[model samples]
Target: MPRTQAGDPLTERTIRVLDAVLDDFGGRRFAVRDWTGRRHDPPGPAEFELILTGPGSLRAMFFPLNDRTFGEAYVTRAIDVEGDLVAAMRVAYTIIETRVPAAVRARQLRLLLTLPRAGTGRPRELRARRGGRAHSVARDRRVNDFHYSRSNDFYRLWLDEWMAYTCGYFRTDADSLDAAQVQKFDLVCRKLRLREGDRLLDVGCGWGGLAIHAARHYGAVVHAVTNSTAQAELAAERVAAAGLAGRCRIELTDFRALDDTRRYDHVSSVGLVEHLGPAVWRTYLAKVWRLLEPGGTLLNHGMTGKAGEPVGSPFLDAYVFPDARLMTIGATVRAAEDAGFEILDVENLRRHYARTIRAWRERLDAAEAEAVALVGDRTVRVYRIYFAGLEHAYRRGRINLHQTLLQKSPAGRTDLPMSREDWYAPPQR
Candidate 1:
């Protein structure tokens, strides 16, 4: 490692930038390591350390920096975090909230530019490369493929046995991820009042977990749809292996492409609406309304942005779910109502989602080598930071998980039970 001697220009500039950032943010829980192996300890005990591997690391992270740049730097190894990633993120979030005067930011940019560019190297395939008009079937398919087709085996390493990639309902903090996921599926089924011989549609069913569960347990005839070819293929295998071929079918199609004439007794859109983008919320709700039989239930489950949260982050948009957008619960409900669906119940499971994502992060960390082998280090880093940041966001109430129960009422009638008693009933043996 190169050492920065006294009067070194690079060392002087690095220290100046670091001091400016620390002074503006009051950072005290984390330390920073410069390219010359020089350490700047925080005022308080450090929980994590930000390691700038080269001169360009800071430039790569801070120059033209936005919410996405830090993530990109981490994934490309221009910057690395040692120790608690979540803790590091908390500090970062605090710093982001701190206001810096424009003049100060401009001065920092000047200093950043003077440092040699740490070539980001061949831009690792960190973002989706989909083409076509956003939200169009062709584009949506490409986006979903980019996110879900990475590796089913890789997902299996972290996801529960059911392979659910959504928030799990934890009756208690003691519940295991698998148990909570099972509870979540059951909760949705109960809310929908699923019954034997009913026709069910699961939009954006990931690996057919909920579809198979609903079919096997509730005896519903389930038709699941997804745009990812890999997901559909694996879901078909899971459905068949569960001896549910007669009861469940997984289709490689978009939710928007589903035939409108076919009516379902119940419809479930879990962790899918985020990808619909706010612009298509009405279209999405109306389509689901048309697909439901009279008095049929529709459970729309997904993440909701806080009232004042930014619309979207560049990092997530580019790397995670391309073109995905989150809407507030109020907006979501209004759209459903406008589509002629009456909102029966709305539940916020923000803490549950926080716990769920934390579990995912831990599992991913435990399987770091396998994950890297499966998807390369860059992809793993993307997920690592993403999951950690998501967990933090949920914990802080910046976002929430909403399970909304809606009904396509026939003759202004909802056949729902008198109270919420049934939803909490003990599961039958």
Candidate 2:
């Protein structure tokens, strides 16, 4: 009960705010509290807890923030989550999707705008220092070292068992990361219509996950190429462990150096193109075109922006992936066509990535005790922020994951008598 006239108005306003949040959250119930709104000095029991306190106390479920602050907190091991990060993200996104009043949204945007931009004088200076050119081999090693040499143990703490550093495709509700990875590998193989006699080339194969899969399951001869020495060595060890020594070979060489006369029936590169940078994107595509046999399929799985040329995130560049850059669909199409490969299909696994990152973050959070011990405080913080930031990017459509399937022409036309590759259920299901 309100004691004063003003108290009633405040109580009514709080209720409205809570209701609005719930409405936006697809009618899912939540217990909300006012840590930001109430309890100035002496924090009450309900101050941090999700419970009602008094007249102005509102109750609704609140999502753990996934903003820049959350990222920083995760990196620092401040906040934690209990279960199903993917579901939590979906709930969070749905709530964010609700249209807030223009005034409120504008105020939030203004605050964001007021934050000091992280820049080196001008964006041009940042771009110029990197000089849109692939410099000497010595210079290139710096970029590779910056990103890839960030400890295999550190990556395994969060990534799948196969050390797959890309978005996973989940099939069933009960599927674990291991299962999703196996399914994703099979999906790619099925998409390429891989057969036992097929000679497969995995471009930028990270730790040889796909190569091992193809060799073991489809009995394909796989040549996995990667520039990272750590990846090559680890991939070889993994292949030998899987008894795939006869069917697969992992090479520590750049795709540019692949000038073999033999062609591949299927070529795939998972989450590798962004490192090629702007200058070599075209050249990279040309190499892929030359590597694939006529009538063969190529799968390029990487991130892309939805609209106009997306600028790189400064925070990500400095703290996460140093030389990584995202491309747009239009640019990818142009590059593939210029390289003489016809685009057969382009699927945006944008939402799937949001879910994937959420799952990864959740897993990382769950194993925090062990992860922090394995990699220390700084590394854990970096990943927490990285995964959350990545989730936000995908959810907001700022960045995306695209699986574009391209095919080289055999009879000057792409039409082939291939069986239906949809024999297995779709990835979304």
Candidate 3:
């Protein structure tokens, strides 16, 4: 807390109220400084500092005291995180988890009343547009355009060579993003037991990474689907460049729009389930099941919410992914089972995601100027916050990355090996 200044009751009151509200935050690894340039250090070493620029900044940060408002303050420069952003994010998350008493809330509002009120910044474009039924095909197209229609160059700035947008598997912190992404794609293909001339379907195939991998490395015939127009165009270009034009096809449409005339030996849906509503879980999985040949495997990779974690990031929904929503792992598995897919394997990749997001954040920070030029300053700022928040969430187990392996198995028949030994065995000499 700030030292009591003589004849400065306002400072004293602000300190008391803010401190009291944050009393539950015992692990204060970061300091909080008010607008007056007064730094209030916690009782120990600090890795970062939360800097509030003015009275409006304080109001914007603490009035509602949620993820969305705190995000707004940062995007508009009302509040700032000095020093390590991830460390500061840790502290901010703790504060959000702190439940203020009703008395504290009352005192905060009363104190805010005396402070000047201005420049909280305009609200975000809510869910890209309101009034439509959530997750409808038309509404979803608009949402995809809002989030994914940004310059492909912007994403290419940080993503790997394949431009895979999903989480990558990491053996250690030292692995490069490209290496991890290769391992991830190959891992998915190996899990499906891909072979030459086998048909593979990739739904929600961002930038066509997995499809390209299946075709180039596994020699599988690839058919990929994506709703983002930008993704479809770029992926098509990439496919042709890889000289797999005859074997690979990129479809510019939603996964649901696919005709029933075709089926695949393997189906992969990575980083897409979160964009689907929980109510549509059965429908989505059933579609994947119908698209897969009996005895074929389907790899469903996505981030899911834990039972007790905070529901969703309003900031993410508004600014990052307008249609994203997480369902619990158990719920996801149950849905797949109900959709006629037998659960074969479930592995959590939470730590991998932490490293993946951290790498992206650091890469973005290093290429700040290029990113800003490509997508403008606001988008860069929003994504920086998005990465930091996600890294923190993964570290805290608020979210999980699940690679759920399901099979369109006929009873007692699921091709070959009964054990997972081959899944991790060393390569033959």
Best by lDDT: 1
Best-matching candidate per TM-score: 1
Instruction: By lDDT, rank the candidates, best first.
Output: 1, 3, 2
Instruction: Please rank every candidate by TM-score, starting with the best.
Output: 1, 3, 2
> For every model in order, what is the number of clashing pairs?
1, 7, 0
Q: Per-prediction TM-score, please?
A: 0.95, 0.71, 0.93
Q: Provide the overall lDDT of each model, using Cα atoms, as 2-decimal numbers.
A: 0.85, 0.66, 0.81
- What overall lDDT, based on C-alpha atoms, would model 1 receive against the true structure? 0.85
Model 2 residue 235 lDDT?
Answer: 94
lDDT of 1 at 240: 84
List model 3 lDDT by residue over 338-427, tens digit each.
778888899999999999998899889899999989877777888988899899889989899999999988884866577777666533
Q: Please list the Cα RMSD from the true structure of every candidate, rounded to 1 decimal place.
A: 2.6, 8.2, 2.4
Candidate 2, 1-429: lDDT as tens digits: 111123345444654454444443344333333323332111112112122334322211222222333233333323333333333334444544456788765543443343223221111221213333453444455566556666777678778889888888777667788778778888788778788879999988988898998898887999998877778889999999998898999998777779767698889888887766656778778777777778888888888876753456544665566667777877887888888888887878888788888788888888888887876666675676567657877887878888888889854676554555573665452
Q: What is the Cα-based lDDT of residue 164 in candidate 1?
A: 98
> In model 1, which regions exceed 4 Å deviation?
1-9, 96-100, 122-124
User: Which residue pairs does candidate 2 place in steric collision?
Assistant: 30-60, 30-61, 31-60, 31-61, 32-59, 32-60, 75-381
Please provide the root mean square deviation of candidate 1 (C-alpha atoms, Å): 2.6
